[model samples]
Target: MFSDSEIPFDVIQAYLETHYHVHGRAPTTLQVGEANALLAALHETAGVACSAFLTACNPFSQQLEPPRNLELQEALAESLQQRGLRFIGGIGQHPANGWPGEESFLVLGLALDDAKALGTQLGQNAIVWSGADATPKLLLLR
Candidate 1:
């Protein structure tokens, strides 16, 4: 079961099932609703109580050309950089589904309100947010 949202049920399922892989030192994968020890450690190491995994590609889940998606992702990265936010590259991959892996970012220390605002501003349907508990939750925007 999933929360009520404009997003399709199947799409929500895909989101929950997707592996959100974070890169750089201490690479680890995050799963929805599951407490990740690595993520908890990362939060401690990064000195952040919260983080968000988000992408600017496939606005509202509408598939876009690879080049366009790449452009959007790069823009998102630039936006974060401009804000001076610490972030790590990530990818949301759902192997069970045929959808391609989406490039995302694990933005450290982004508050819930700010994360939601950024996701909305980027036209994303949802984002994965984790608190101090380090359990990722799918937050629908539409």
Candidate 2:
């Protein structure tokens, strides 16, 4: 779990604004925190050496079909690997909100420049952030 002191409210707010600009709605604080925590955990688990984290959220609404979700997951993994990024652990149902229609968070670790390049390539399919900056950089591949 990442502390609020590490992420801060302002950073989360900025992320929310970026998310809204891409998704057209605001995500709950829990959703934002879940992504941040997952990213931080990846960094910590890697001994604080990861330069950036790339995360993709597969929302239930977009994955009504069972195979669609799995396909998305596989595609995300393959995409990261194709770019030479490392796939880290992912969290299902961020925040454990106990909702039937929660989202899945897929995490990837890569260099900051690589992550940024991938983000540009993805173009709204996922969210990209640098651990060093603590600010969301891009939303890709939607």
Candidate 3:
């Protein structure tokens, strides 16, 4: 599994190539991981479906105290410990706790149940995408 402290420049590419065994082309970002929305949802609920938490930060979006809190972290940690899901490379500067940005991506771990919960919580703020399971699509700040 990939460690949060040691993500390579071509980390995502390497994961795809190694796991999928089909390295057709490399991507600028990693799109083969879990979604940010789902991670947020699980954090909000504090449920058992919580997968690993892959911090995604950029120059734009930053972390807040309310929306994401210590309780959420505990829940995520507990849930992930139970599940077999592994935390991989993130989409921002800090792989552990990245800052947020507009269009910035956050790579999080989530099970199917967690994704469903996220869909319900998102309601209007987020969208349901089928192409990739959990890779966040991040954008840069000025």
Query: Could you give candidate 1's per-residue lDDT for residues 1-142 as a string of tens digits?
Result: 4556878898888888999999989899999999999999989998999999999989999999999999999999999999999999989999778899999999999999999999999999889999999999999888
**How far is 127's C-alpha from truth in model 2 (Å)?**
1.3
Highest TM-score scorer: 1
Provide the overall lDDT of each model, using Cα atoms, as 2-decimal numbers: 0.93, 0.42, 0.32
lDDT of 3 by residue, 4-78 (tens): 422343533332322111111222333334344544443444433333223221101234463443444345445
Decreasing lDDT order of the candidates: 1, 2, 3
Better of 2 and 3 by TM-score: 2
RMSD per candidate (Å) reads 1.1, 10.5, 14.1
Q: Residue 65, candidate 2: how far off, in angstroms?
A: 2.1
Encode model 2's per-residue lDDT on 1-142: one tens digit a residue. 2232334444334444432111112222223323454445445665554443333333412334656656765676787667665454333232222323322333335666666565545333344454533333533322
Error of 1 at 123 (Å): 0.8
- Return the TM-score for each candidate structure: 0.96, 0.43, 0.28
Consecutive 10-residue window with the lowest summed lDDT within model 2: 19-28
Per-residue error (Å), model 1, residue 73: 0.8
Clashes of each: 0, 11, 13
Candidate 2: residue 66 Cα off by (Å): 2.8
